[model samples]
Target: MLSEGWAKVYITVEGDSGDIERCCEKKDSHMEDLSLQYVNLEESENLERHRTEGFSSSKALVVRRGAPFRVSLQLEDRTFHPKTDFLRIKVMLGSLYVIIPVTSSKKVSSSSWNAYIDPEGLNLQSPSIFICSPASASVGCYRFQLCVFTQESQKAYAIGKFILLCNPWCREDAVYVPFEDQREEYVQNDSGLLFMGTPMNLVSRPWSFDQYEPGVLEACLNLLQVSPWHQKNTRLDYLNRNNPVYISRVVSAMINSEDDLGVLKGNWSDDFKQGVHPSMWTGSGDILKQWAQSGYSPVKYGQCWVFAAVMCTVMRVLGIPCRVVTNFNSAHDTNANLVIEEYYTETGQKLNVSKDSIWNFHVWVECYMTRRDLGPGMDGWQVLDPTPQERSGGEFCCGPAPVKAIKDRRIDLLYDIPFVYAEVNADVLSVIVSKGRVISYSKDTEKVGSLILTKAIGFPIHQSITGDYKHIKSPTSSLTSRRSTMSGDSTLSRAGSSNGVSVSLTLDRAQVAGEPVCFTVKVINRQNVAKKMKVHFNAQAKEYNHGPSDAFWETHGVIKLAPMEAKVVHQQILPAEYAHVLGDNLINLAVVVEDMDSQERVLASEEFNIASPHLTVQVADSIVPNKVQTASVSFTNPFSHPVSGVLTVAGAGLIQGKVNFRVLSLCPGGRMEQHITFVPSMVGTKMLQASLSLTNISSTIRGFKMVSVHGA
Candidate 1:
């Protein structure tokens, strides 16, 4: 018989690692000795567990490694003696397990995990203790159990599960991020910007990461549980979960369904009746929830940006700092030759002769972590793409490809560093073909990686990070700081091999949707004699990722240029001629010159994006939590005809779920204003987003406003 009102609790974990078991086994004997003479363990209470772990106001029990979190233990029997009874905690993930003694006298290795009874824990009817996992603990869902060991007997009680993740806030963690502000923005901010459109006409589109939302964290954990890596080899996956490198690669693969039963099914075709269009998605919450609730079946549609943004959410939810990045003129070299070959006719018409592609802007995520697998100095931001463009290690996922290796051209490293290097550094080989033969060809080494953009820290604007990817200096316009993708001045030029004639294309200015396609073709003759040439000007509508379709507009004319003469021919294609053919709001404009005498053809082409009309989201600068706040959405029809569609509004901390309503019809250039109200439930800087999607037009307009919420 022992003292009353005392209960001993212990948590035990199962694992194949004998080192952990030996460490835990040695501590258990010490704990048994402490039971012979009891000791009261106490620790200072911390109310900011959720805040410090960046999961405040979130529903899941997500704590970072090396951080302590509390678990309340309720006992059915209370008549136990403190000297003869104690507690043990058991936590298990896959085959790795450990049994932790909560008493301070049995303190185990600080390099692993530790537990302590927080002040009279065993003396009370309901015991509350602090569980602290070492910085090296594997990241995943851990099954927590509390077992009572009394002098007479021992019994185990099962409790709920908690998730452990990498700790960017812990100095001892491998994923540690030193700065407080960057940690907040990268790991905590729920919304951000995704740069799209062309480098000349950048679009700062908004995206809701929805990482802190309820069920999102759960879904992220569930995602890992359902991944092929975890399903095929749980032991290896669980053991490697401690390394961010392996976790990121698995997550990148899980973001698409081509290789496994993953979260999203990528759709790049025209028909989307079976599922939602890629452009209609405003946030990752709906996509992730749909994936989890539907028996892990992949969600309908997602593109590069959506995949990257969703991966960002998963990385952030797992406590790894992440951000979405866009590369203008991103190349996809099909043959691994480090060059993308493009063929065009003498009449400025693109020929589908190569497997290569150049996306106007390709989006992916950059996760911040130390790359122990790739050696030192390689640590920092590593590019991870979930678009399923290429398969690495026989799986449809790419990278943790170190950005440092990319800049230094160190392709002999692990992951997909070579693939990523070619994406930004590939040479563009433009060939002119006439009569089933190559007339002339030109290579542009600097064209593929013209711009790389990411959202600035603590601000909604985007800044150029191009220099980080490419070591060499860029063109004149590449260095200018960009707040909005609104500005432009990039030029395009290609010529015949050492010929006397040259052709170049330049945009008078950035072209916008619903406006005429405007640009000029300059032809120069350096020969000492006059020459007559036939000019072929062509315009074709294209997706940012695919090659140009049939030419929507074309013209042929004769021009005469004397020696030391330069000519600029202005061209325009009306909105009526192009709006119907646009599938992805992008166009390929080209002009080819055929020397009437020499028959040598020269080509110059420029790919430009027809930017969508901006959707305006406005709300009060400061909103009170738990109080109703009004937000307004404004949009003007940029088409030639009346347009109508659905308008969706979403917010993380500002609104629950999402609100959708039918938008009234609006004529060309007609403006529509909508107001909606919702009561916020949390305090912080939150994004209020509205998206206007149309069924007829191929463009989606989006807007987001970041507002500070006042605490109640």
Candidate 2:
């Protein structure tokens, strides 16, 4: 298909070798120059291809082995469809000579083919020849045939050739050109269109790895060809927004209405429903399934995105424009309050969930709903989540009434009132009401009606009321021995007179038979006068039926002060059992007036232990040989408190063995030391626990290390 007049060839010797003579011939328009360097195998026995001019370079063959060797080929680029009609390469060096004939078609695209030299046969004096290209091929890319021969062989020793021809299935877009291009043109070719929608916050150089691979490109082309979307009048924009939801809902509704949609529709297979579930969007899979069976699912239905997507699909089907946005915010919305306790009771599990902890992830969705839901003049811009029935549902809507919304409603009242006390059939006051009107009211004026209140009610009442007016004086009713009101005094309980109602309490854990428990007491003012408030504290003895005579505890101290002026009463419980360690065991403490008129009065409890933690060392195990195979040490905890101690091993190769510890510290540089450490002597695994005699000691502890060795 091509003439020799339009072809040219060039070649040069390559590698560490002498040149082999073989002049290139140029017939008319075809110039075969055999002078340029040709790439030869750097190492013998290896194969390599050589290129010259163009002509889709050809592989080299060792015609004659010498210092320098090269390849020869014919090149042609006249017009686009050009080909070589015939090619032959001859080699001669010293007494060596050979010839090769080539035949080719035009379909092969690569520029070169490999020619190998046999390591055993090729030598400095051996002669070889190779013939390639210029074959009876059509106008297309092709490989040339290569033929090898030697001076002694009459018929061609080896013959090979290749050719390429045009194919209708070739991809024009996938073509690559390595030769000619301007710098500006090259720059413009590399830049692709940038995505403009959405926030392009991150910018970086384009990546080639993400480019469609050969297989992917072929698949895409096949898909496009099958659908013929360009010729079909299909609404792609509407399809993009509505297709997924239509499929999702169809799948969901089918699943919900039938026990087995696959059975109803025989065409459906089990594999198609592998990952599908009734709870489509619930983050927690198990919880959703459980709730789903209950007829009213919580978590699954609460997934705002799922509902948002479904709703968006519905809206689009109805010709409405909308978009979905997802984000996380605190429960309190703006202030980010981190200390609100929310207990979920629907799941029948009572857990005090706190907003302060790290689990405080509040997720919600936003959608463009009707604007009238927001406010006036903003009727069509209401952004909210469709799943409003969820736990933390809907977008944060700070409407016009924000001033009246209190985020922290739990602590609105300083104290909670579990119960309140009131006067009933007491020699007290009475109030009469008629037709929702207070007809009459009266009291014992001087004394308040008998009121029995528990701590729950007393605390809140104390925090609510400071200066009192009349305990039971009323403006209307005549004196009576009973009281009448809308809410009867049925909730009240009789607590006897305030006098002689003495309650002596102590920290049970801090007190033992022979130990002293430190505690404080405050006496508030119930009367107006600066009366001397007599205070007394005594440790009552244990009642024993067969013991000697009963002894009454003597009052340790007393405080006298004016009315309304509170005094701190410090006391302790002293039993005879701890007499040996009473001096150290006595929890010494003094009551300080930390709060004056403060409703919140906190008492401090101090702890005193009689024993201190100390470390004692003992060689746990010894082996038969003086040089032990693996030695181990154990530490025991024997103190009333926790202590931190360091154990160190000084012998060499100490760090080479397997070392483990629970209480000992492991140091570097073979300085085998640990708050705990383990050294294995035998060739077996030993389960060992290292515990230190920990004590809350203020200073460095003294000796007390107990060790016990057990066989592994």
Candidate 1, after superposition: displacement of residue 615 in Å?
A: 1.8
Which digits, one per residue and each the tens of the lDDT, describe model 1 over residues 100-130? 8777544545477788765653546555678
TM-score of 2: 0.17
lDDT of 2 by residue, 1-712 (tens): 3332122323323222222223122235533321211222222221212211111222322211111222332212221111332334443321223333332332322222223332333332221223222211111111222222122111111122221211111122111112223111111111111110001010111111110111211221122122222124224421321222222222222211122211011111213253332212211212222323333223222222333333332222211222222221112311232222222111111122332211111111112222222233322211233332212212211111111111112222111100001111112222223344432322322122122111111111101010111133344231221122201221121111122111122232323322344444545444445444333332212100011112233343334446555444555545433333321122212121112232111111111233222233344454222233433443333323333543333221122222323444322211222343334332211122222222232222222221222344
| Per-candidate count of clashing residue pairs (backbone under 3 Å) | 22, 82
Model 1 alpha-carbon drift over 4 Å, by segment: 1-47, 50-60, 72-85, 105-110, 119-128, 150-153, 474-498
Q: Each model's TM-score?
A: 0.89, 0.17
Candidate 1: residue 562 lDDT (0-100): 89
CA lDDT of each candidate?
Answer: 0.79, 0.24
Q: Name the runs in model 2 displaced over 4 angstroms.
A: 1-566, 571-660, 664-712
